[model samples]
Target: MYIGRFAPSPTGPLHFGSLLAALASFLDARHHQGKWLLRIEDIDPPRSVPAAIHRIPETLSAFGLEWDGEISHQSNHHLRYETALHQLQENQCCYYCTCSRKMVAQRHAGVGYDRFCRTQQHTGGAVRFISSNAELIWHDAIQGKRTHAPASIEDFLLRRRDALWAYHLAVVVDDAAAGITHVVRGYDLIDETAKQILLQQALHYQTPSYAHIPIVTTTNGQKLSKQNLAKPLDLSCVSEQIAAALAFLGHPLPESLLRAAPQAQLRWATEHWSMERIPKRAAMAWPGV
Candidate 1:
């Protein structure tokens, strides 16, 4: 069974940009007759908005992107993150680093961490995964073959100095626990794949296949995001929004289906979903945004 997920951070209401990722993952899963799960990545409480948790699912429902089974919240899985962190520590695959961002920038001139703490025996700071020497290689479903040498990969964080579980660790653990066989998300996260793969190797977990769709960006070349104050999706025009998302993904619906219901548009999308049709570019400015 192919299990795919759209794990959105509950930082704000769902916007047109996020719909691209959510719709792509939903269509791809439905195309393969797989299960599509929704996970709320609210591990960082300071950044999470309580109202958005309820609003996100409501928006998805309004757009006819219903998920499978009960929704999973990252906040509910602290023990699992702790267990994975412990396993990595026990295997000597990770070490604590006390270097602050300012200190690292001053020392390494803004390059990735110099692994200064890797040998300094630091304690009580963020946990950093040891970069593997072998090349990180993977065939992305949409972006094609990707290869990164060990030197290009950094000793990324597994746990933050604030004690929150890092996304690299939490996402890898969650995907494995849920038996997710495929990960379809935005292209902006493409760079994070190597780090996650490293964690999977260290923990002996299966790495799901990856597909990074082009990200929707503003006219100024900024990715559409809450931090950028992108406007939320207009619930009054669900069908129109779905069509816009489909067209952006390189699968424009027929004229007759333009005014169809949300489910109808998605049904056509699921039947015709093609990873190859998506634009190969990393980011495309959202038209008329």
Candidate 2:
């Protein structure tokens, strides 16, 4: 069974860009007769907006992107992340780092973490995953072959200094646990795919196939996100929103179907979904729908 997921961080209300990813994932899963699961990535409480959790599902429902089974919340899986971290520690793939952001920035000249703490023994600060694997190459279903040099791959954090589980670590653990076979998300995550694959290899987990659709960016080139203050999709205009999303994905719909109800629009999208039609670029200007 092909298990796909759309794990959204509950930082704000779902916007056009989020809907694009969600709709694409939902259509791909439905087209393949696979199960599409929803996971709330609320592990970082400080960045999470409590009410956004309730609003995300409501928005998904409004768009008729119903998910399979019950939703999984990352906030409830602290022990799971910890266990995974411990496993990495046991495998000697991780080390505790005491370097602060300021120290790392000054040392690396703002490129990324300089691995200054990789050799130094530290009591408690942050846990960084060492990318020792030589084969840092993977073929994305959309973007084609991707290769990353081990030297350029930073020793990313598994646990933040603030005690929050890092997104990279938690995402890998949850995806493996849920048996996710495909990852359909924005192209901005294409770079992170290699790191996630490295973590999966460290944990002896299967790397899921990846298809990164083009991200919707503003006219000014900023990716549409809560941080960018993108406007939320209006549920009252669900049909138009679905049509616009389909068009953005290069699946323009007929005028008749464009005015159909949410379920009808989703049904049409599911049947017509094609990976070849999706843009291969990393980001595209917002369609102004």
What candidate 2 gets wrong by more than 4 Å, as runs, is 133-135
How would you encode candidate 2's per-residue C-alpha lDDT over 119-140 as one tens digit per residue?
A: 8877778899997647577898
Shift of residue 279 alpha carbon in model 1, Å:
1.1
For candidate 2, which ten residues in a row score worst on lDDT? 131-140
lDDT (CA) per prediction: 0.93, 0.90
Which candidate should be chosen as best, given lDDT against the real structure?
1
Q: Write the per-residue lDDT of candidate 1 for residues 1-289, one digit (tens) a residue.
A: 9999999999999888899999999999999999999999999999999999999999999999999999999999999999999999999999999989999998877568888898978767899999987888898999999999767899999999999988889999999999999999999999899888888989999989999999998788888899988899999988888989999999999999998999999999999999989999899998755
Model 1: number of backbone collisions? 0
**C-alpha lDDT (0 to 100) for residue 51 of candidate 2:** 95
